[model samples]
Target: MKLFNIVSKTTLTLSLILFSQNVSQTHVYAGVENASPPAVGKTAKDFSLSNLNGKQIKLSGELKKGPVVLLVLRGYPGYQCPLCTRQVGQFITSAAKLKSANATVVMVYPGTAKDLNTRASEFTRNIKLPANFQFLLDPDYIFTNAYGLRWDAKNETAYPSTFVIGTDGKVKFAKISKTHGNRSNVKEVLKALSSSS
Candidate 1:
C-alpha cells in the first residue's frame, strides 16, 4: 500500500507538470514583438524615453522581433493636439491588426519637464493601450532634438513624424510633417509595417 501510494503521488505530480507546461505554452504572448525606426535602409538611432508611468523604454530593446512603428507626438504645445489625439485613437483601434503582424508601436510625447507628467497623464487618461503599444514621454525634447523633430517655436514642440523600422535596427520608412495636421495616415503606416517586417 505504501508503494502504491508513492506511485500515485508521482503520477499526479507528472500530470500537473504537463498541464502547467501546456498552459504556459498556450498563454497569450504579450509585450513588444521586437524592432527600429529611422530612415529606409539606414541604421536607426537608438533612443530611450520614460513613459508617463516613469518607466524607461529603449528602442533597440523593443525591436527584438524586427519591426516597430514610431510616432512622434506633439506634447502639450500650449494644449493637447487634436490631431495627435485622433491619430492615437486610430492606432489603438487597429492594435489587433498591428499585433498580428508581430509589430510594436511606440509613440513619443515631447515637452519641457515642467508639468510634463501632469499634462502627459491628462493625455493618456482616455486611452487604453494594448500590450504592443507604448506611449513614451520625451521630457525637455531630448529625443525630439536628437531626431531633428524639434519645432522650437512658441507654443510648438516636436514636429509630427512616423517611422517604420525593421528587426535589423534599420529605418525602413520615415515621414516628417512640418505642419501640425500633416501627419501620416494609418493605412500608409500599416503598409510600411507589413513591408518592413
Candidate 2:
C-alpha cells in the first residue's frame, strides 16, 4: 500500500508539471508569437541608421530635445505594402499634432542591403513626411533584430511596431501588431502622447 501511494503522488506531480509547462508556452506563443513591443519602463537601446540621403542619425540625438516616436516599417516586400502606406499617410495627416507635442517622429525602413537606397527613397516619395520627421534605412534588419522586432521567417519581413521614448530615453509607450492589419493608428499614438504629457 505504501509503494502504491508513493507512485500515485509522483504521477500526479509529473502531470501537474507538464500542464504548467504547456500553459506557459501557449501564453508566449499566442499572446506574443509574432511581435511583442518593448514594455514601458524599459530603456530603449540606441541605434544609428542611415537615411535615404546616406546621413546617419542616432536615437540619442532625437531624444536629446524631447520625446521621440520610432516607427518600424516593412520595406520592399516584393512591392510596396498597401497597409504600410496607409499607416504612413495617417501619420502625415496628424503631423502637426505630433509636432505640437514636441515629439520628433522617425520611421525606420528595413530591407536587404542590395538596392536599399532605391527602396528607401521610393518609400519616402510616396509619403509626405513633416519637417520634424525623418526616415532611416535598416539594411539587413540589424536594428530590427536588436529590438526583437525582426520577423525572420515566412512571408513577414519585419514586425510593425512603435515606441514613444521620453527625454530620459525610456520607453513611455509601445504598441506592436501581431498580425498584418492590427496596428496602432496615429490617433491612438497621439492620445498616448497627450496622456503622457
Query: Which residue pairs in candidate 2 have backbone atoms (N, alpha carbon, C) closer than 3 angstroms, thus clashing?
Result: none
- If scored against the real structure, what TM-score would every candidate get? 0.79, 0.79
Q: Native-vs-model 1 lDDT? A: 0.85
Q: Taking the tens digit of each residue's C-alpha lDDT, what string does model 1 give over 1-197?
A: 99999999999999999998888755532211222225578887888888877889999999996588899999898899999999999989999888988889999999889888999999999899999999998888777876777787888998899988888888878898889887887788888877765
lDDT of 2 by residue, 143-172 (tens): 777688887777678888888888888888
Local accuracy by lDDT, each model: 0.85, 0.83
By summed lDDT, the worst window of 10 consecutive residues in model 2 runs over 28-37
Q: TM-score for candidate 2, please give it.
A: 0.79
The number of clashing residue pairs in each candidate reads: 9, 0
Q: What is the Å distance of residue 195 in model 2 from its true position? A: 2.3
**Candidate 2: segments with Cα more than 4 A from true spot:** 1-37
